[model samples]
Target: MPLLILGLLVWSVPHLFKRLAPEMRAGLGDKFKGVVALLVVAGVVLMVIGYRGAEVVPLWYPPSWTMHLTDLLMLFAVALFGLGNSKSRLRGRLRHPMLLGVITWAVGHLLVNGDLASVVLFGGMLIWAVLSIFAINAREPEWERWQGGSVAGDIRLGVITVVVYAAIAGIHYWIGPSPFPM
Candidate 1:
């Protein structure tokens, strides 16, 4: 539990620091990016170790209905994730579509998996995404909508979203814990 909590903090704090402490990041200058990268790598390693060894305590069982919700939500999440880096008009409306996608994905997983490990991992991610969105908004108050996103780009994003989402689902199925109900 300690490791899990530590990993979550390690993963999120560096990201939060840039928004929360601009002066600190400025003081660090160019090295700040390198520090963040190291922290992320360390955090990922800690999370992998902690999650693998952590005791599995069963929480409430998710209903079968949640699986359906997961399918739909994951589709939306991936599309939103793509929108984050895309020049689509849809991206213009969202301040941080990637973080929002993370929140969506985390919430969907939390709903479907009620074990202690799942709760810690997914819940921590959800918290981090929400906090990051808020911190980013606070840091950048001005919003400028991107102008003239071509319809072709939007269509291309849809194709990419479907292909990527399918690949992710296939990988999940191949590895284990198939998201779909048999």
Candidate 2:
């Protein structure tokens, strides 16, 4: 749990730093980017360790039906993630699409997995996403709305999103938990 908490801190702090502490981050300059990257890697490692070490303490028993809901949320999450980085008409309408996707993903996982480790892991990420969005909004007042983009890009990206989502599902099953229930 402690390691997971530390990992969460490591993952979120450097990201929050630039927005929360502009001057300090500026002072660090180019090196700051490297530091943030290293911290992110270390954070992932720690979280993986912590999560694996943590005992399973189920908070709530999820119904089998929730698996369907998780699947729906994951599809939208992946599509939102794709739209976030893609040149699409929908892209202009969102401020933090990727963060929104993360939120959705965390919510989906939380809905299905109620163990202590799962809570700490997903809930921590959810909080980080929300906090980071607020911090970024506070720092940058003006948002440049999407101008225009070809629908073809969106279509292409949508196709790619489906493929990537399937790959992720496959990887998830290969790992431990099967996001796609049998």
Candidate 3:
């Protein structure tokens, strides 16, 4: 849908701006962060509105087994998202943990959702994540690996991941069709 496409563009453009046009983004300075945040929020709103309103044009029906894989991937995605911010030893394992989480989430959703709107939403996010990874790597080739985090940090991350995952599942249940397979 047009709104969905527009939402994707609105969300991605601000994110890619700093990577693509460093000078222009830098010119705006820290103040630009607020503007970018607002744009991202608006983009999410548009995407939700578009996705809900779009007609279901199914491309292919996914196998029932895909639901299990989707759940597994979603759990891993949540862990990766928490891993990025946690002071755990594993923090250094991946340079772009949160972006990787996004990729995982998108892939998981794509596995179960074969409709046009879902593809446009999840697939667009996948493309954006890949592009973002490429852009970040091109800009900063060197990475300083993290060190010296204790196991306690990992324990904390695990707890947080569980909480967040439950919250997400709750939201999905509250909204409409639940993510859980019958």
Best by TM-score: 3
**Alpha-carbon runs more than 4 Å astray in model 1:** none
Candidate 1 C-alpha error for residue 40, in Å: 1.0
Q: Over the stretch 1-182, how does candidate 3's per-residue lDDT look in tens digits?
A: 88999999999999999999999899999999999999999999999999999999999999999999998899999999889879888999899999999999999999999999999999999999999999999999998987767799989888899899999989999998788999
> Candidates' lDDT values, in order?
0.88, 0.90, 0.94
Candidate 2 residue 44 Cα shift, in angstroms, is 1.2
Q: Which candidate should be chosen as best, given lDDT against the real structure? A: 3
lDDT of 2: 0.90
The better candidate by TM-score, 1 or 2, is 2
In candidate 3, how many Å is residue 131 off? 0.2
Per-model tally of clashing residue pairs: 0, 0, 0
For model 1, how does the per-residue alpha-carbon lDDT over 1-182 read when each residue is reduced to its tens digit?
77887898899899888889999789998967988999998988888778867898999899999999998999999999999888676878887889989989999998899899989998999999999888878878888766667788789889999999999999999977897999
Positional deviation of residue 29's Cα in model 1 after best superposition, in angstroms: 1.1
In model 3, state the lDDT of residue 179. 87
Q: Each candidate's TM vs. the true structure?
A: 0.93, 0.95, 0.97
The positional error of residue 135 in candidate 1, measured at the CA in angstroms, is 1.4
Clashing pairs in 3: none
Candidate 1's displacement at residue 79, Å, is 1.1
Superposed model 3: Cα runs more than 4 Å off:
none
For model 2, how does the per-residue alpha-carbon lDDT over 99-156 read when each residue is reduced to its tens digit?
Answer: 9999999999999998999999999999999998998898897999977768897897
